[model samples]
Target chain A: MMDVKDRYIIDTIIEKCEGVRDPALIILQNVQEILGYVGKEYLEYVSEKSGYPLVELYGIITFYPQFKLNPPGKNTIKVCQGTACHVRGSDRILGTLEELLKISPGETTENRLFSLESVRCLGCCGLAPTIMINKKTYGRVKPSNLKNILAEYEEVDQYVVE
Target chain B: MMKPRVAFFDFASCEGCQLQVINLEESILDLIDAVDIVSFRETMKEHSDEYDIAFIEGSIVRPMDEERLKKIRSNAKFLIALGDCACTGGVNKLRNLLPVDEVVEKAYGDVYDNKYFEVEPAKAIDEVVDVDFYIRGCPIRKDQLLYYVNRFATTPPHKNLDMRFDVVPKEGEVDARSIIQYNPKKCILCRRCHVVCNEVLNVHTIGISQKGNRSIISTPFGVGLEGNKCIFCGQCLVSCPVGAFSEKSDVNKVSAMLKDPSNFVVFVVDPIAITSFIETLPGSDRDMGAEIGKIITALKEMNAKRVMDFTPYTYLSYAAQGEYIRDNRTMTFSSWCPSVQEYLEKFYPEYQRYTHPETSPANFLLKTIKSKYPEENLKIVLVSPCIAYKTSDAFDGVLTSRELSALFKSNEIDLDLYSCKKVDFDKDIEMERTYIRGVRSDYSYARLILEIAYMSKFHNLDVTLNVTPIEDYVYEFAFDSEEGFFSALLIEDMSKLRKYLSKGIEKYNLVEFYPCLHGCISGGGQVLTNSLETIDKRIAMLKEYKGVTDLKNDFISQVIKAYSQLKEVI
Candidate 1:
């Protein structure tokens, strides 16, 4: 059973999907955007409304990397692991973050505040060894500077709440 | 034309289809004489890469498999997919439900890292390489294989592969296992099995889990049927179009039993199964009785010690139902249909108390036989159109109508060749006049209930019975009586059954749920024919048989005694 908000979001997404080609993909993307992730219930609801088998919908969901089945954390830390980043010792920086956050890449922290990910490229090659936390990018970040950078987000959380 | 050099190749599979080629019996000599068997892993030790025609079995599940299949494609002039795995990706595709890495890890354990081949999602041979033709079935049908081999022998090498042959569309595997096997490769994602299991039967034992090309019809959460609510009804097997859903065959075991001189094999065939068997060999001059006689003769020729019709037990079941109703079990659900009983036991346990406690007709007859002939080493081989009976422990072996046909055809014993003669049962069983010949329609059991009600003096009976084709799946039987107006509904297909149940069926006192639309006659084990006219014709033939007989004075007392004993046991 889905909550009222999730149901409304799905209903709205389904309505927007009307008259569109490949409504299944469209509806799925919309639901993921509104809810931060696509769950089985939403997929089943969409399947029921769209008249598509849930198995086909699941196939589409798993095939594409863009679709997430789990909710994202409040803050996402994306470390560039592209060719340029690798040359600049991004692996050391990634190791440092994983140790500090106590979570592997593609996993969320226990506090639900941060998610760590090592992406192919952030497309910011000029700033090699770069790590971005919720739109704020730190260029040429070293392993030693990781704690200070993480502390800034914790401070920001208190400041915003206060 | 140098006997088109033939080779057999396998990927991820059980190689049962390849084994079928070996199991061709006497016709195997003809196949050997016609085609040069260059390579066969199961039967022959020698191998050859240079082959004009290649018969590939199993699904492509690894990168190496794709590369090998491509090589085979380049090497061979024609590539034919053998069995459900090679043709449709069969049971191998079940792993597609999970991540390849996860599946590998779970299967290989700590040694997964050292594995040579990288596991990928299983796909039909056609997905990776070009396939000229397909021999469909979990294990390819031997007769169909023989027919194709004969065609390949006469025809040119590079003919357009799409040329359809008059191949007999037989029912899939009829291996008498306790569980129904769902072959993922042959599954077309039709969801008919899921629909039938969840909706029509209300068993909810199987559903489509996982998404996309990886989706498989399985018990919820990938659990085996043993722990699940699956009643072993095998409605899913009948609904599946391909070899995706089928029962394991016990043909080898039955054959072995027949050959053993020490064994006395009793072939007990259901009357309805006789109709289905006759239907398979279309355009036969033999009527219902003639077909039965011919089948008995054929079995006898195969060394069956005693051949009997299942009508005696059918009468017993009818009598039991009558006795149950007379006992005033407020609302009685017929337990004759194993699937319906399974549905009540698994889904509607509240109604379990109301169900008749009598064992199935097959079980009763087998039990009676064993008890009466305790000294003999008796093996009961139940021949029926119903796949559900395959799971029952009462019979030593179960063969479907299609299987019976295949066995006969493979053995070169043509039913049409034999002249119909009057065949008598080993023992004369007495039946009462109260017996009614069961029809192939869905309302037949419901009619029995109504008859029982009438016989019990439930006056002013207003009965409404609905019977339709398999696709329609709507069979509702309701009756109004002066003594509290007992009403019952029988639903044929799953989708309608699901819809009907969703609305709540508290109004009806009794309900008969069938997985197949027209009861056991249209069972999964029957020959594959979707034509309504053909089915109707078969039903008409079933109606022609007078299975019921006048009861002896002692038979009534026996039924009463059995009912009393059954009540105490329950």
Candidate 2:
């Protein structure tokens, strides 16, 4: 298990509070930024910092897809499921990605480098079944080539690290 | 010389296509000079009892249209099916998938005398009468009308002409069960895939061979299209009206590209062989050379193509295998078409049949360009109308006409400004028009297929052909199966809905699915409405201004000479 950083968490909290008024919104954004998910640890951290009750922080974070507090993977793959994307066979892409990565939505790989997530109607429905990895977009992706897609990035990431 | 007497007739339609016809005001002047307009009810009150050419619009749904078409056919020397409704039964054909009586009842069961005039099944003009030529599109392109009128007027009568096409019907009817999996029931064989393949893509992979009731479009030797070389581009999905051909879409990839920036993006525009981009783009009768140049410029400006058209030598490796299969007297399959490859990879994996497939014009051009530049930074985006191209996974991104429309919509491609620019055909080099066109002619897979087919037949080799072009099969099978490979993006809740619906169920809502019905036209960011006539006029404009310029370039000529030499040697 990776140890959490306090300064990094404080920095994210400060970033959220810049213009936002709703305490729940700040905490939700804060939890997602800190732990990559809204988990128990994030709720505890929010209660201590903002003087908001743990129950209150948990209530907001769990409700929205934007908030996350768990120890998410180092690389998150968020796939869009919208009407345009759906007809274009975006479902199989998600399945193919899941099979290739060996992780379902909300789960991280053992290496902690990959986390799979699903998003709704990313406003680019024309492109349909769109996938995002670490915030980078890949359009018109098909299931037949899912392995190669993940492999390309992983290979590049490894090369960069080495 | 007496001009041909022509009349325009409308059926159950919005009369939009007719309006588009009238919108060709300048071209209409040219048309009026050429033809004797006997009865154009839309523009003139002058009635004609006789006509040589009857341009029919709309689908035959009402009892009146069926009789009206017969009278028009009887009076006219030739009947030209104009617009999609006149060709493929268009939007009204969607109702064909349902019970005609039920549909009519839903619209007007209680209001009027339902017993007096029952709604007939919607059908194209060809279904009702002998149609001489078909000008397809939702609204028929003015240029195509000009092309047909000019050509037909000059040519001698069909009886006097040396025609080889046998009009007689065939003996055996197609086992409807074999093709009709989802059983839409009203599967009028529009064979838009056949036209898209042969006319547009030039991939002689799908076509209607046998006549009448036996007429069916299939692969070369009529084998199941599991996996051949047909890259899924999804053009056929948009072209067909009654769901005769369609595939599960990959809209998710579109979402991904928008979200990601690190990925290099390049879209491949199918040269004239596959689709007339000029016609598909917004506006009518503009200089194609300039318009195409502008589009290429726009794309290049967007940093879409880091590489020019690059040929994949590996496809040659695959095509060589196909040639070898012929040489070795073994059954050979073409691997050049993406749909063919996908069919093999998905359904017919047993035919792990490797063919030394030649590079497509798209891959040839883009790969060469990408290799020359930043190969690492190269993310090839293929802007094609074909659905099979979507499945290739070769280019970094695959966009259909619908998808490109959405992309253009996103950037707000000012078509008015695009059209207004004085097209300089000379400076088209900026868009790499010559280079792309040169590569396309040198590497057209259909031309290659025709050459191969000719040689195969000439030699009388053991060739049993089952050639369903990628464009056709992708359309035919897309959105037909559960766990179908076409699934791209679906939320958990929607995914659950998809799971509950049967493949046969009209799960696709017309109101919602209407935009995507034509695929890219409905793409969220499309620049213009999907109008076939508009695109066609653009195509004519492109041809007039460009005028074999693509072939004239030294680079293209050299490539043509090289390919010609290769053709002679091979």
Candidate 3:
């Protein structure tokens, strides 16, 4: 069952989407923006309101890589796995990150603190085997440096809280 | 007329449609006489590129397939899509859900690199080239194919052909309406289930999710069906020409319960089951009553403690609803159809208040039996054409008319051989008036309810009753009075209902929706037959059974007795 707030958000999004050609997609995109992710509840609510079948709505969400079904973690780690990064041994860096965080690429940590993902390229080939955590970039990333990098973000969270 | 040279070809498919042609029995000879079999990989060793008509029987999934299909299209004067795969990219479209590379790797393993054909999403023949006609179904219907072949052979080549025989609409993708299990492997992706669910039933619960070969008929978000808005109507099961969508069989459970000495199993059958049994059973010339008798005897042989018709309970339900309406004077929705109740719960939750709280005939019977025989451990099993009843909590087991036939066949209890004796219900149950008949039509259930409402003295007031059979299966009934106005809508097919509901239901008092068109007579779990003539025959047979006319006296006495007994028990 959708709560009052979620229903309000969906209604507002649907209201804004009036006269839009692809309202189901538009509603889904707007709801994703408002809620950070398109939950099943929201999809069903939108489905009822829009009259678009839930299967079609879910299909639209999945067809686009931009839309996320799950909420992203506070800290997102993107390891460049482009040709340049591949040649510079970025596979080892990704493997190390996966081992350290206990979560593979496209998966978030148990604590919901960190998410790991592999991008084709970060446009930072000059620094091959590059890894980005949030806004900061760590070029020339190695398997050994993955633990220290993740710890740095955890330490920053502790510092911010203090 | 010169015999039109015909060839059969398949791409990515099971070639089941081609097999249907082979399974034509003696009719294959007539078909062969009509058309020259130039090339058929299924049965023929001969090969020929020359053919006036080409029957293509699968989806194009590779560049090689595309090239071959184009060649066939260019060569043949008329091209016919033979099956669901060739018609609507069938079950092979599930591959469209995943990346081509991933699919190839998973399917072929390391040998994928050595593959000659460039892999693509499975596509209907018309997607690539013009298809002159389509022989629909997972495996094309044998009779339909023969009809087309005869027409092609007899008709002039220059004459325009009618291609509208079994064509599904090319637009509006949606999911199935019921809880019928979809086996991706067996699904031909003909979209018949999708078409019937969306277009016919109007319950947009099933649709093509993903794209290409990876595409599958799935509920919204690929969630478990129980969580989805599916009404578990099982219309998709009957609509599915392939084994893709089928009812979860409770045959084994029922059989086990019957065999258990400790259990007092009660086998209750709906009135519609009589016609279905007569139709399903081979070489059984027995009428509806005789067939029901045979079925009762067969169940008795299988160790059933009690076998009874559920007609009395249906009357009880009607009486209860009639009484409630007289007292309340408020419009109440009929809860007799489980599928309608489910639809209301899922789609029209706001209208739930209007739904009559009375239990269905099957449930009422079970409750009555359980209350009457408190010491006996009763296991109620309902045998009917209704697949929706399987989801009901009232029955321990629900069997389709077809499944019941299968049980009889398996047990070697041939109905023809079984002595047809007049079977009686358990001595405790009263055999008053015979089961009501002629109320099995599209709007008949609602019509009967209205009749009952009228008999209950509600007709004394100016009551405007509007009974509209919207489609083959769906009906809308509206009742307006001086006090208030409420309408009861019965939509048999989900697709039509979905469309009506989408427009927002008008101020309705009570609504009755059925998943199967034409009520339980043509239920999803019934014996599968392509002929509408068979349904007509069954309806005629059901109508032949006498119905109670003096509802004021006969119905009132029965209702009064049942209610008094109920009050005593409480």
Residue-pair clashes per candidate, as listed? 18, 126, 40
Question: Candidate 2, residues A1-72: lDDT per residue as tens digits?
Answer: 224575466546756676666666765665565455656655556555665544344434544556654577
Model 1 whole-model lDDT (C-alpha atoms): 0.72
Per-residue CA lDDT of candidate 1, range B216-254, in tens?
666533446766677775667766677676677767778
- lDDT by residue (B1-570, candidate 3, tens digit) is 579999999888998888898999999999989999999999989999989999999999988888889999999999989888988999999889999888888888877666574698778888999988877787677888988898889884443343546544334333233336667766667888777666665667777766656667777776656777677767777667666666777778887887788888888877676677677655645566666677788899899988877777776776667566556655566767777788888877976877765656765777787886675668988887778777767778888877787777666678777666766555444546543444434335555555555555543424556666666655666565554344466655555655765665654444565666666767777766446777778777776653435334455455546654664663
**Mind giving the per-residue lDDT tens digits that candidate 2 earns over B344-399?**
45434654443323534444444454554564655666655445554456666665
Best candidate per DockQ, number? 3
Candidate 2: share of reference interface contacts reproduced? 0.00
Model 1 off-target regions past 4 Å? A1-162, B1-178, B188-221, B224-231, B282-286, B357-359, B409-412, B426-428, B432-443, B453-487, B493-509, B547-570
lDDT over C-alpha atoms for residue A87 of model 1: 98
User: Against the correct fold, how does model 2 do in TM-score?
Assistant: 0.32
How far is each candidate from the true structure, as Cα RMSD in Å?
17.9, 26.6, 15.2
Query: How high is the CA lDDT of each candidate model?
Result: 0.72, 0.52, 0.73
Query: What TM-score, to 2 decimals, does candidate 1 have?
Result: 0.54
Model 1 in CAPRI terms: which quality?
incorrect
Q: Which regions of candidate 2 deviate over 4 angstroms? A: A1-162, B1-236, B242-264, B273-282, B305-332, B343-354, B357-370, B419-557, B560-570
Sort the candidates on DockQ, descending order.
3, 1, 2
- Rank ordering of all candidates by TM-score, starting from the highest: 3, 1, 2
